[model samples]
Target: MIEAPLGDPIHHLLTPEALRHPAAAWEPFRHREGLWWSEVLDSWVATSLADCSAVLADADRFCSDWRKLGNDVPDSRLTVQILDSPEHTAVRAQLVRAFRALDWDGVRDRVAENVERRLAAVADRAAFDFMAEFAVPLALDTIVDVLGVHPPEDHRFPVVSAQIVDSMDYALRPETVGPGRAARAALAELTGQWLDGRTSGGLVGHLAAHHDSGRVTTAVLRNSLRVVLHSGYESASRLLGNALLACLDSPGSLDALSGGVDDTALQELVRYAGPVQAEARGCVADTEVNGHPVRRGQVVTVLLAAANRDDRVFDDPHSLRLDRTPNPHIGFGRGPHACLGAPLALLLTRTALGALAGLPRPLRLLDQPRFRRNATLRGLERLDLGWG
Candidate 1:
């Protein structure tokens, strides 16, 4: 496949240079114009913060379920992520109820336990890979604890999660499609059993109760749980890595947190380091973004990463301000399909960062940060650090 021209933001999105330094790469294209037509991807890319917000806010004209626009979306992808209005509202409620019903105190306690244990284990080391040693394991441990499910002793969670993350990048590289599908199938089956009361009682069991009461279908509960499980673990792991790197890159950013992990500062971290980069919505009716006519059935890609850095909405948009107020970044997204796990993800990050703040020494980055080449989800694949 011939790459799109260098000037195209989509072209540089997955390149080695751009992946390592995406903020700089994206900075040049974040204009008030906000929209670009990409023949290679056959989609309209929305860049400006205002435009991206407009597209997400008006779900009536732009539908998340591209199947309406002739794309073949798999059943596995049919959770709250793709649903439109009325149905989206109901299905989202089922999942949100489960989230709200969580033992929040227990959740915080468990996350703190894992963070402290991991920090202690690596405290004596001269240097360590934060991704491998801390973020990944802590994410997995929290998943099992929160879900209250016992794995078959096969260490398959991370393996499957990797396939799913790769799948997000599949549109750019077709090779990952198969493994992504297979992993989803395997995960769906496991979640099915868990949601059917075959596994230990936790979030799955709570959701299964909803299914039993005819509040939701088996497919809805299982698929929704599966999606939550995948994103809950993978998104946290990636975001932690990204947020840490962001803190270290900005002088005194870590010191600002040494006082305490305030919600305002944590949110600034979310805006600065969120892993989500883009999401495509199909046009259900004729609409125009910033006076540019978008025909029905056309694909509109929202460049959320670019929007986060758009100077139109943020002052000194490139700087990391721990107390940046009124931050309206679409990191967890917006609209009827906003992220259902936003609260949980925030809780996990807030807890983790709070622990780091109490460490006796200053956090240090051992080397340059390395990022994954995924287009839709941008995050670090490797982060070596020393705070011991």
Candidate 2:
């Protein structure tokens, strides 16, 4: 039996400062081996790629349960993200097929139009919160198009989506639950309407078609759709926001990316600033990791942000080098559960970055960006920026 490492896991490893500033906070433990406890979640946190890879690959050993993190709100399981194994495989396959078969060129054109329109609407301002003005709408519109959701122009999709995503934060205060509940309710209602055929050839249509063929049930379809919308839109939106900020923070890196740097360079940016930080998994049965005893029913959280920065895998782990090769970073995760939306996400990020870079004046970060409090889905909550 491997004895627990001595020290207050949170204090010895992660500090409040680190929790708030993950990039800086993760520097010390990036390459260090072993698991540490998180007072915030009262669970063991794995920061190394090897450990994360070990847990992710052994899905039977480490299960994924959002409820383990206290996300027991009603309709929580509607999202396919919480499912595992046989059920997970079936649902994920259906989702992947539908998502991949989407009209990507059409989607890209629509996104570009949306970005231009939104930016024009806000261009008059010298500086504004990019999250609210650009990223949120871009994400919301993309999801609305993908999910085929249609409501009044004054619809609340964006607000509700933000609330649901925000509720996943580990540091969520009691006050935050109200908004989260509202978001869940809104999503449930919207998903129900979509199920009724008010939408078109979007995620809803795919699920509905599958439901009619006995491929999926109405409940599973609704829940899965909601989960996809939440994961697809909210997380990607935050990542785009952060990636833009990262580019602005380091112009040299941005230049490399914009100057048609090779795929290797682009891969580094994705590794260095790829969004979606820590992912949660629950142990299904007793197992030993790195000679340490991992009992069944215990929760394990894989810190992607920390893992990507692990010195064992990356040199100058903290710095963003577009040319960094042998980049085995798990930005999109690994194993059977790897993100199915990776291609779409890459297209969206690439387009957004390319658009921002072409602007006449360089974009400037107006303030220290704020991060969403959720430990699992990491990204910027608000990023203020301006361009001349």
Candidate 3:
């Protein structure tokens, strides 16, 4: 058996500072061959592309439920993210079909309108935090509207979503857990109310009918809606912020996108600067990953960002290539647990970028940005930008 490496556990690896400079944070361990125990995380860290893919694909040997990862939460089997095998397969089929059937053009139109409105509001200001004043609101409103719920004109829904997303972080304080759980429960109740016998056209109504037909459990229906709401906005908002920053950093990329890049190019942008840095899975059975042993009930974190930048995969992993084809990055994850809202996220992203394409050259940063401190979610809290 290969022994786990010994050293100071990587602390604050997900801090804004660390995430902003991933190479500095991960360079030391990039040379490590396989899975090694991280004392800081009390979980094994998988850095290489091969190792991360192995952990994500072999679901029989690993679990995705949070309860398995030491969280004292309610039963999670009904949740789309945590469900395994047969159940996950069935539920995901329904969700996938429903999501694909969504009027993506309509969604894009709505999101584009929202984006224009957000920009109009900030057009008068000298500069504003792009994250708070723009990305967050646009994401929250667009997703909520598509899900058949009225987006509150204030910060209520955004606040709730942020709380739930933050709770997913590995390092949770005692104080944080209580609020997170409460927010989750509240969200469930809110989602159920929105879907209760509503005939209005939307994904939630279809799910409600599915629930009423006895095809799906109440828990499954409610939690699936919860998953969409949580996953849709949190990741999309951060991705918008990251992608915008990336475009500003590379004017040629902005020019290429402005001139109309295809879905493949949009995907390349996600691969290059997507917000998700890492993902966690719990090992269920003894298995060897990339020739390294991972025992039952052990947590393994796949460094997705690292894998995206792996030299063996992309021709120039660090360079932003708009036309990179066959780019099989795990930005949305892989296997059965791949992001369910990926299509919607991509649509929204395309619309957002298209809107940004109209901005004047030489976007300016009004102030230094601030990033959230959550270990799992990498996003900016504030990014002040302007173009005059």
Query: Highest lDDT: which candidate?
Result: 1
Worst 10 residues of 3 by lDDT: 1-10
User: What pairs collide in candidate 3?
Assistant: none
Clash-forming residue pairs, model 2 = 63-282, 78-223, 169-374, 265-322
User: Please, what are the lDDT tens digits per residue for candidate 2 over residues 44-143?
Assistant: 7788999988888787678775444355636545455666666677778788777876787788899888877876776778898988888876876787
Top model by TM-score, which number? 1
Rank the models by lDDT, top first.
1, 3, 2
Steric overlap count per candidate: 0, 4, 0
Q: Model 2's lDDT to the true fold?
A: 0.69
Model 2, residue 268: C-alpha shift (Å): 2.4
Better of 1 and 2 by TM-score: 1
Better of 2 and 3 by TM-score: 3
Candidates' lDDT values, in order? 0.79, 0.69, 0.75
Compute each candidate's TM-score over C-alphas: 0.94, 0.86, 0.91
- Candidate number that wins on TM-score, 1 or 3: 1
